[model samples]
Target: MVSVQNRRIVFSFLLLIIVVFSSYKADSECDFKAIYNFGDSNSDTGGFWAAFPAQSGPWGMTYFKKPVGRASDGRLIIDFLAESLGMPFLSPYLQSIGSDFRQGANFATLASTVLLPNTSLFVTGVSPFSLAIQLNQMKHFKVKADELNRAGGLHILPPSNVFGKSLYTFYIGQNDFTSNLASTGVDRVKQYLPQVIGQIAGTIKEIHGIGGRTFLVLNLAPVGCYPAILTGYTHNVSDLDQFGCLISVNKAVKYYNALLKKTLSETRTELKNTTIIYLDTHKVLLDLFQHPKSYGMKHGTKACCGYGGRPYNFDQKLFCGNTKVIGNSTVTAKACRDPHNYVSWDGIHATEAANHRISMAILDGSISDPPFTLNNLCRS
Candidate 1:
């Protein structure tokens, strides 16, 4: 015995309820509340300096106004990614003071390789914190978190909830290639790439074994495009790529990326109900170098902070923000006036500005393999 007006009102109310519920479900699906990262200096927050503690001024002048152990002048790819997810910057696992694990942790360190100790042929002094060690540290963190959750007084989410729901990101393999290239010539390195990638794949599988359902794996950037590589390596004029980068070195990167993609595809099939997004960082970086004006970059081929002349402006003897005695004269490595206009921060790492642009593309899923962007992967 309801009036016609009452019937219409009830229908509208039901429609609103359905819409609200759908929106909530969508938000929950995309709500990646935590993030765990692993890699080298490309993604290291502070793990390297936590152990060595030698970083100083102008290293973080762009954003932090002081040295913060980041290899770059400001933030890193992992930092921007965390910010995009509305999470605070991840604390380096080794950092003791003011560290917050509620969001997640960064286990990356400078110059970390995938190969185990005594296995890397190119790298000289091996650190104890390799990818395997980082994974072990992650396991320890999970155990501690689980204990706290069981205690019921101070809980940082159950380890199961953290690993199962959080996003696990990796930006490794560049150092692996660099180390191998330095020790064993290019041909030998190429021969060993498959084994190296297999080890990387095995590590990913280990993470998968642990409740890790989501992965954001970034492939190697164009290593030849790095000013340090260009300055150090001898390249034939005919072998230079369109961007004047070392063609042979870049070819190796392409080969590695292809193998990595294939390995990830096989992994996807093996690990059911998992989301894996392979980010094409090489292409993105090449595009940036090719069209520097488009990204507001003026010095795409040079280090923003170094003591050297043009073309690369990078020095092997003087690292970024370092002062060295050249012929008994103190020559200091100075930072660029406008770091935002430069792509390479210190001949190796990307500037915060560059990382921001790359991160935006990643968030929108523009440069990801299979077109499943970070947003889509998290929400799906």
Candidate 2:
């Protein structure tokens, strides 16, 4: 239990640290030279696909017109954000070919968790590129980039000064909760939240130590509302909320975000000249789910891809773009013709249209704590 004084400090910091945004592009004089991203598939440009040559297909069809590494049908929140900032899409740190890291590098990968998994990727399908590992990779990137720049490879990597001028974005932690939900249960998941939150905080501090002054830490989305979760969990009708999402799982996500926010608040006081903005991902995502029509989405909760029909369109085994022999017939989980109409792309991630809406909320300051946008970061 925190002391009353410590709790007060946390609350004050939240108000002080999180602030406003007027517009996405018009007020875009916020001159961030580059962006270094750390997260799961939510922001992964191509790390996982580059690492593992999976047999899956038909991703990135909406925008990229090919499998360009994102789990969604097209660009993610990170892509929209980069475009808003007038920066090109960040190249994945793991992708070796045709990737230009002069602007930034994306260290995020699919199925990545905050904590390092005990099992290997082959055994559990969880990414080995955990938060700590991403941190190490960032550290190494700085060292190597500096070396390359000194060795006349200026065009290959950004200048050393760009590190301090970059925006460090984190869209991780969702996978951490989702992967453990079925295995450990919500109560057990709650018990480990502090460690998870601590890892997130510690990563921020480490980035600050390495000259990262600006950060965008995102809270977990409503895990209960995810089609994958809804399909996987054993919840009766009474366990669901009005939107047909599991109340218990969302409650756990709230608890996790609360802890995350408290820790981020404290992080602000510890770092000097640092600006940390914790995105209220739960609120934004829940709001998006509640009013899909408001965002011009047709299916609020159903996934646009996957095997299972209706409700969620998610199957644990038969994933999106996957073709397998299911007892009698060879079934393929293909994407819907109108991917833009969906809130969920694969029952796990948001569609490109939904990603744009989320980015809009972030940049427009509706979900910001102090009602400020990236433009305010320039003032801070």
Candidate 3:
């Protein structure tokens, strides 16, 4: 014999409990449902390989045990990030067959530049899928995913609401500097950096307009310290820095980073509600090269999978896992016995060990601007 008020209280309590439990979705700890990634080879899982020729050899030997279209011998930073967030590995948007876009998709490609290349992909070896084109692809993906979900054919596609709740990440524009650094020199490359940064800013805004609220932007790595650049560009005695890195090129890299940080700052102001983070890839890599002991690395600047001997071990004509006919014999650029000891994987990209280090730095909030940790990206 409970009173009327007590009966109402019991009903209200039961109703509230039902509502709370009904909303439980087992979301990520960070509250991010999915991740939409855009970048160049640094994060390219299989875009270029699917769209064009696939890379062979020991590209993914270390971890994946086979060539998975990634330029690295194992996982990239993006892979580690997905693991950290408890999400499935992202598939390439261009990869049509056997792809699962239920978690997210990668739009990055090898040799991809933010700006459209002046020449064809074959001529310059730069990717045709620039940032703008990637954005358009994302727009189309959103609509198609929703349609598939409505049709009950979206088992492989993410829910329509995921596009807005997903984290938008960018690791591009490295080629924008690298491609021009050799031909155009630092001055000319510096002049066009604004355009590169603008393109990235606009891309973020576009994602935001489509309901994206979280973003993680990675700045350029230290190209001057890369074995590829060191081998490609011959520097005089005075041009080398204390660590034997190119002084002039590193100066230009610093300049580009400064401008990039400023642009991200402005973009953050414009998109007040969005969570924009700038991860310092440059600083993290430079420290790894300069202080290898700190990262348990031995061969700081040398490439683990390239031709040439000793100090850098990178050849301009011979890339890692490439084969060429020479003197009636075929020579392949093979990997080292101990890739974990080296920093550079193919003189251009980082080894999986190095990629892990970079991811840890960001997760620990050491190299990220505004100091956001992995567990909470949306926090101020």
lDDT for each candidate structure:
0.82, 0.86, 0.86
Would you list the rank order by TM-score, best first?
1, 3, 2
Every model: Cα RMSD to truth: 3.0, 12.1, 4.5
Writing each residue's lDDT as its tens digit, candidate 2 over 1-380 gives 99999999999877665543335434556668889999999999999989996735578899988888898889999998888777789999999888989889999999898988874312287899999999999999999998888888757689989999999999999877878688778997788778889999999999999899989988899979888999988888999988888999999999998888889888988887888888896787887787888878888779999997988899998889988999899999989999988889999999998888888888777776535586454422
Task: Provide the global lDDT of candidate 1 against the true structure.
Answer: 0.82
Q: Local error of candidate 1 at 258, Å?
A: 0.6
Give per-residue lDDT, candidate 2, residue 186: 90
TM-score of each model, in listed order: 0.91, 0.89, 0.90
**lDDT tens string, model 1, 154-230?**
44343457678888998887777876564466677788778767876777788888788888889989888888888
Clashes of each: 0, 6, 0
lDDT of 3 by residue, 288-308 (tens): 888887878888889999988
Give the Å error, residue 244, model 2: 0.4
- Residue 7's lDDT within candidate 3 is 98
lDDT of 3: 0.86
Superior candidate under TM-score, 1 versus 2: 1
